[model samples]
Target: MNIAIISPGPFSVPPVNGSSVEHDIDEVTKMIDPEHQVTIYTRKCATYPKSSVEENREFIRYAYKGPTPYLQKIIKHIRKHKPDVILVENRPTYVLALKRHFPKIPVFVNMHSHVYGSTAMISKAKMKKVVRLASGFITNSEFLRRHFMRTNHIPGHKIHAVHLGVDVSPYQEAKLHSSIKKLRKQIGLKEDHRILFYAGRLMRGKGVHVLLKAFRHVSEKDPLARLVIVGGTGYGSNRLNPYVKELKRLSEPLGNKVKFVNFVPSVKMPLYYQLGDIVATPSVWKEAFCRVNLEAMASGKPVISTPRGGIKEVVTHQGSGFIIPPKEWSKELPIIWELLWSAPHIRTEMGKQALMRAKQFSWYATAQGYLKVFENAVAKREAGKQPLQKTG
Candidate 1:
């Protein structure tokens, strides 16, 4: 089967920087390649030069750096390819554009989250309608599926929970002591200093500021603890929020104890994970599905996430890691600190458990599940039968 995936995210292919969604695309393509042909459609902002067409590992990438009017060109390209099924990843803008002009093809809208915080640019009703018109729907977690049925008014049958995939091969235990020691030296981290790592957009909705506040509280107790933040200013947009600025200001009092590395490539993330004693996904809102937590778990690092979205589903209390409510970081941090300081062996044991749990969610399984959905859409269309539809 030939498939076309459209995403407004600038890096549709293997994004040079690092993106969980792009990582998903890469892993999924690798798994489905021998049996299917896949093409990815990505957007490029005006300021940056567009990357040339490159094909590797059985997938081709097409980039659009032109103005908004070039969407017609996207439709034309899709029409020419005549793919078996079209999958659009997020971005209600593309959904509105395609639904308005090109609704003839069987398009599936894959929604990763129903987060209504900063990026919830579209109305819930409209998003639900887009899902209704599509051949089928794919979501990252049951939390999002329930949000669709209850809030977006979509039917249960139309929605499928296919959690995002993570690569666990890198974290497989083989005595990575040398690699860990190298990273510690590069980061100026001492042997006794426990590393607490956070990676994601340094934005408010991501709860970075809140995490900073909690880290300060943790610092009061454990001065040797280091907080390492990894993420960029977010895709060429320098528009800084006050909370982000405050985070920068707050990092100062800690001196060199707190480190912020703007952005690291996805390929190099394993080293950072290896350096971290514990990984945190402190999302303010219910994250639709956080790949960061999965990556930490894959790296054999215990995760500390909020009781939001599918985070609790991914990390169990005292098992893979701990799941505390968003504002309860005060209540949670001490316990995490205690785990890191008092129970080093227990943390290592938990990290081992996390790696084992991470393997259960593989790109191969996710890609095969996606293939089944695309095949069903094509089969239904070929049978001259309309997919059964339901509205909230």
Candidate 2:
């Protein structure tokens, strides 16, 4: 089977660290069944050739001015070497355009977030039409599967929710004493300090402000506790946005106890995950999934996250980590902090369990899920063609 994966235009493949969509694209393609030839289309990155086959996967990068130009760049490439199946990541409208151009091929749209399919971004009628044209709608979590079905009115069979995977080996590897110590020294972490890490976009939805508020209380009680906030407003964005100002204000009393690290790419995330003795996502959004929980688990750290969206799927309350109810995070954090600090052995045991759980969610499993979606979608679409076409 020949497969073509089209990443959104904003980022390049092999991920520049800021784009989780690109990172998923890069990881999935690497673990794809080698018998099938894989081609990836992404926006241009200066470091890589426009067209190059590295490790058996072909990457085609085009200079992108905007989404329209970038889609055209992909169209020109597809006209020449059309694949058996095409996977569109992030943009729902891309599926519509691809279906219009290549009526026979199976085009699957994989949604990383709820932002695209929501009526806020596109009209409900247009979203339904996009769903009608595409072979399958894939989401990063089952929660999102129900979302599109309700919002876009897509049939249950046409949508699949495949959980994203993490390359745990990097996080696992970074646990070596010297490597972790060097990272700690660089961050100015004290030997006795217990780090509380928060990584993700520094915005309202990610609960950055909520994290600061919770940490201010955590710091006042436990002098050894340190809060490390990772990520900028967006990928590579360093400007202090308004929410960041609010977060700074919240952290004022804690002062040096709170550390806001700038945005680091996906490559450095492994070590950063290790920076936390215990990680806290503390998200308030009903996001499709939080890769932070997965990465933190992979690094053998317990996470304190809300039971929102797919986070409930990855985090087990008092098993691998704690999944606090959204309404209870404020009341619960102080209690959970006391428990973890008093019984440090639970942290070690939970870390072991977290790593074991993290091992189950591998990039190889992610690829297999996509491959299964490809096979089933192709078979279903082909079966629906010709005599069954009009009804479909």
Best by TM-score: 2
Off by over 4 Å in 1: 43-68, 96-104, 115-120, 123-128, 173-182, 235-241, 385-392
TM-score, one value per model: 0.86, 0.95
**Clash count, predicted structure 2:** 1
lDDT of 2 by residue, 82-174 (tens): 898998988888887788789889998999999977778778778888888888888889998998888788899989988889888888887
Looking at candidate 2, the ten consecutive residues that score lowest on lDDT are 383-392
For candidate 1, what is the lDDT? 0.74
Give the distance in Å from residue 34's predicted Cα in candidate 1 to where it truly belongs. 1.8
- Each model's number of backbone clashes? 2, 1
lDDT of 1 by residue, 335-380 (tens): 6877667878988899889988888888888888898888887887
Q: Roughly what TM-score does model 1 have, to 2 decimal places?
A: 0.86
